[model samples]
Target: MNVTLRQLRAFVALVRTGSFTAASRHLHVTQSALSGLIKELEHGLDVQLVERSTRRVQLSEIGEAFYPWAAKMLEDLDSALRAIADIKELQTGVVRIAAPQLMACTLLPDMVTAFTRQHGAIKVRLVDCAVEEVLDSVQRGEVDFGIGPERALTAETTARPLFDLPFVAIFPPDHPLARLNRVTWKDALAYPMISLRGEYTRRLSADLQAVHPELMLEPVHEVAFMTTAISMVKAGQGITTALPYGLSIIEQGQLEARVLDGPRISRRFHIFARKNRVLSPAAAGFCDFLVQACLKQDWVRLPEAVSR
Candidate 1:
């Protein structure tokens, strides 16, 4: 009824090498010790597993039948142990993340590049979608985590604040607003604005209204994606407001990103993960690295209570 790994290893080695002396040499064990292990294995299994002669060692009928199974067991065990070691060393893993399109295009790429350089063995997969989709991805267990703005986290998901990206005005380089050191929300509202549709626009309006009730945001264009809004701004259609996180995209579109003041409005981005799920070591490591990288940025304000 009792079995041990040492006994199984000895049996398999004896079969492979075809001699107790050779098997002992391969295992770095005394021949007597190797023979004793085989005896113990045979006694425990209540079967004769080897036929021995002065000239050679061969597997008996029962041992021959079990050899394949024993070899397979050892192979599987070795693979499992190696995988564990790889995980511990951060030498193998996949870190899946879902993030808003704007962030995926801007803030995330730099973080990903830095992370992959330091951890060449670990792979990162990013799914760029809407803010809502990012939340859904984490809640549905589709990603190791999500990075986006604050949301109504379900009981199945948790959010940890990463950083707050102040709302910034994105405008074409030659636009009059771009000439200022900083653009005020009031000044931003006066322009023909290109705005994001749905929740983002609503939140911007609501938050701005709470602070400056007399203010109004009337957009000449409303788009589903930030890229579209950026496109509109680049064409000199109008200015748009977005978190500074997407500065790369704005810069790519030949637009300038200046912090919006007059009462700085910022959107807080969070790291979202399943409530009870344990992240892979690679994912956890990336999360820590991302927080530190974000903190180094001048515009990213980390909450005082946040931790690695």
Candidate 2:
């Protein structure tokens, strides 16, 4: 009852050293202070913990029983503190992130590789899901955070701006549109277009219609994943539009990307997380690193507000 760590330490030090002077030296406290602590501990416990003598000290029956318990408590606390220190220093921890499958395959892999190389002990786990499911993973507590294009956010979630990149037209290297330095929406739409299904195409169409009503994204095919669209483009099925961040996949597909102008429609990407939840040190650190990585890319135009 009302026992303090200093009192327990003093009792343990006295038992281990077998003398008041030695215990005081071990604790870097004066002999009188050490004696006072020991007295306080015994008084609080209502037991004579130490048999004090002029030249030696010994633990009483109750002290002998409590020594192991107190020592264990201190040892466990120290171990926990060390573990926290390791996490804070980025020496060891896990950062769980979710993203659209295309980003998980293209942009996130490179960024994760760079981050892990710098912080060798920290592990980054990326969950690849549908573009629409990125925020669902975050809300369900499946990931520490998520990266995806801006969407209607719910009150249970928070979004931090990551990148605002202009849409680019992607086609095979030999395609006629590849000749242009920059392709317009009309130019890209001239060919059979393959667009992503659901919210993505809807948002792009809405943005386009807002500026140029006559120009619409009437795609010949609507696919779920960007890779599928890119694959189709590579095979000469049709051309597609995507943000510049997917250039890696486009290049790997033996395709080319050109900036799409004529209203210059852009999409904003954000880091999504559960509202009012505190991110771990590793998660927060990786989020900052990701923002810096995006900043380094010339094509990525970040918003005025940074990550929360």
lDDT for each residue of candidate 2 in 22-72, tens digit (9 for 90 to 100)? 999999999999999989988998998887753468778888998899888
TM-score of 1: 0.86
* Each prediction's TM-score versus the true structure: 0.86, 0.94
What's the distance in Å from true for residue 202, model 1? 1.9
> In model 1, which runs have C-alpha deviations exceeding 4 angstroms?
15-36, 52-58, 301-308
Candidate 2, superposed: residue stretches over 4 Å from native: 301-308
Least well predicted 10-residue stretch by lDDT in candidate 1: 299-308
